[model samples]
Target: MSTRLIIMRHANSRPESDTGLDHDRPLNEQGLAEASQMSQALIDRDWMPDTALISSSKRTQETFALMMDVPCEIRPEIYLAGLDTLLPIATGIEEGKTTLMLGHNPGCEMLIATLCGTYHPISTATCALFTKDGPHWVLESVLRPEALDRFKRVPYEVE
Candidate 1:
């Protein structure tokens, strides 16, 4: 059976905080605001995931937390990950009715570009939605923060 994947970049964060704890950085003000807005859009658009996987980073963890009732798994390899580190996760996923993969970029953008045939730097909180057709997931549509605000339909919601 096809397993859908929704890849989301962690919200804005203080990457330059004096705290050297890369895994402890919290979302900045804008990040929290964006997360609030996106959370609503996701709810309105019915984009909730049954299962969520995240990089074992602070920012990613916070992003996963904003969502409701999503069981989360932490993956260290996903931190500052590249496509290779992400491909296996996408291909190996099983048992989740719908899956949310939250992590950093360029890995997050790179993975979606490789699988979806699109390219962008993936601004914080951007998400690329993919649907599993047969044995592989296909790019159904893309949504950024601006689009989410405008169109809260499913992943295929048009501009």
Candidate 2:
């Protein structure tokens, strides 16, 4: 059995708005639309998550709320968590299950690099798919909001 993981960074947030605190920052209009679009793309690909683990930040929570139809667990530790904190949560996932994680940057991007052995720039609302085979995690694909436009005309395949 293969364990699939979809890791996504929270969508575009209103950093400039007077939220007064980073954790309280909410998703902007673009973020909401982007999350909805990503959700549709996942549905089209039949990749809807069975379970999700989300950071407790408002932006992450709001992003997950827009994109999910399954049960989700909020982990407060994931807010700006480092690779050490993120990897264990990922590796502990049982086989034969698909898990999605909505998290913040640096940690999310670093965790992806640690798992798949390459560092890729992770923009807001970017999702990376990986398949775990035994102890190794293999990169399956990555989806971004900007690519959605092209995907409508032609399927995007990661090389």
Candidate 3:
């Protein structure tokens, strides 16, 4: 079995002025809804992770809380972490175990590019799912809040 990696960027957060510190900014109302929707999307796809590596920032914490009820590690080092810092953590996951890493971007975006050799924008509340393929990682799916409604089947309207 291959290992699955879910790289997610934290949901939309309040401005730094509101919290007086970037680390303390919490998710806004829209973020709450986005997080909830994404949570259901993950459950519907049966992609609930076994373990979650989350950033210690308030927004990231709130995002995860609204998403999954799984084992998690809150890492202070993950705040605004770069690809170099994140790569080792992601690569260290045991084979056959799915792990979710919730952090800020450009680190998340950089990690996805380095692993998949393709760049995919990871906006607020965006999730990039990857699966190990032999010695390499392949991009499996990307879920964004704006595109979630596209999955629904709408009845055709009679002209």
Candidate 4:
């Protein structure tokens, strides 16, 4: 069995005006719903992670909390980290384990490109699933909140 990696960007956060610090910004209401939707999608796809590496930022932490219940390590250095900071972590995952990395872009975006040779935008609440293929990583799927049916809004009728 090959190792699998799920790279995800934290859900949308409240503006810095509300938190006074970028690191302290919390998820907005829409972000909460997006997190919940993505959580179910992961479970349904049987992509539940065995372990997770999460950024220490409040938004990333909250995003992980709403999405998963698994062993996780919060790394302060992951906040707004780039490929130089994240690639080593990805390369070090034990073989055959599924690990999730919840962080920000363009680090998340950079990781996907470095591993898979393709770059997909890592938007709020977006997940890029990658599986190992021989000596390289293969991009499996990219899950976005906007593309999930559960997140679609039903038109309201005026009574």
Candidate 5:
């Protein structure tokens, strides 16, 4: 049985405008639009997850809310989690199940590199899909905002 992982960075956050705490910063207009677009793209590909592990930060929550309609575990540790904090989640995945892990950068990027043995840029709203066969993880696809625009099935209009 193979386990699939969808690791992603939260969408664009609002510009610092007195959002005293970094954890409280919400998604901007563009972020909301991009999140909606990305959500539709995943749906079109039938890539919805059975479970989602998401950071407790406001932006991550908002991003998750905009994406797939799935059950998610709010992991406070994922907010600034390093590889150590993330590895356990990936390793603990049950066989033949899919999990979406939404988190912050540097760590998300590092996790992808460590698991797949390659470096890929993890910009905001970037989602990389990986599948584990036996003990080795292989990257399946990467969906960035630009890529979403090109692959989206439905036209998303920013409101």
Candidate 6:
């Protein structure tokens, strides 16, 4: 049995000038649009998640609301968490299920890099895909900076 982890960063945000609340900041126009595209990309790649774990941050919540859905639940630890916070969170996951975790920067990116043994430049609105093929969740391929970059790069020949 294998567990698939698709980790995604929230989409773009409006400048602070445009919003009053950082904690409740909703997605900007560009962010929403990008998230919609990301939703389609997920469907295209057949990377649909069976269950989702998300940061309690508004951005992560909205990203899931706008992009994809597979019975999402909120997890406060992911909000502004460090690398140390990730593996513990991952350990709780059951084997053989596909899980999507919508989280903040550095932590998610750092985990993907560490597990996949490569640099994964996770950008806003980007997703990093990894899998565990054993009873314990193990490292697999790292598809970093997904949805937008991978979808668009092939057409423009941007590697």
Give me the candidate number with maximum TM-score: 2
Q: Per-residue lDDT of 7-57 in model 3, one digit per residue for the tens? A: 999999888736498899999988998899888878877789999999999
The global Cα lDDT (0 to 1) of model 4 is 0.87
lDDT (Cα, tens digit) per residue for candidate 2, span 77-151 = 999999999999998876898899889999999999999898878888888888987789988888888788634
Scored by lDDT, model 1 comes in at 0.77
Of 3 and 5, which scores higher on TM-score? 3
**lDDT of candidate 1 at residue 147, scale 0 to 100:** 55
Model 5 scores worst on lDDT over the 10 consecutive residues at 150-159
Deviation from native of the Cα of residue 92 in model 1, angstroms:
1.1
Q: Write model 6 residue lDDT over 1-159, tens digit each, in one string.
A: 467888788887675534476667777888887788777767766778889999987888888999765798899988878889987776667677888888888887787776666666777777766677554444443332333564372211212
**Could you tell me every candidate's TM-score relative to the true structure?**
0.86, 0.93, 0.92, 0.91, 0.90, 0.81
TM-score of 5: 0.90
Clashing residue pairs, backbone N/CA/C < 3 A, model 4: none
Ranking by TM-score: 2, 3, 4, 5, 1, 6
Candidate 6: stretches off by over 4 Å: 17-21, 135-159
Give residue 30's error in model 5 in angstroms: 1.0
Q: Which residue pairs come into collision in candidate 2?
A: none
Model 1, stretches more than 4 Å misplaced? 150-159
The parts of candidate 5 lying over 4 Å away from their true place are: 17-19, 150-159
Clashing pairs in 6: none
* Cand. 3 Cα-lDDT: 0.87
Which 10 consecutive residues of model 1 have the lowest summed lDDT?
150-159
For all candidates in order, the CA lDDT equals 0.77, 0.87, 0.87, 0.87, 0.84, 0.72
Q: What digit string (tens of lDDT, one per residue) describes model 1 on residues 71-129?
A: 88888888998888899898777744778889988898889888866675678887777
Instruction: Please give the RMSD of candidate 2 to the true structure.
Output: 1.8
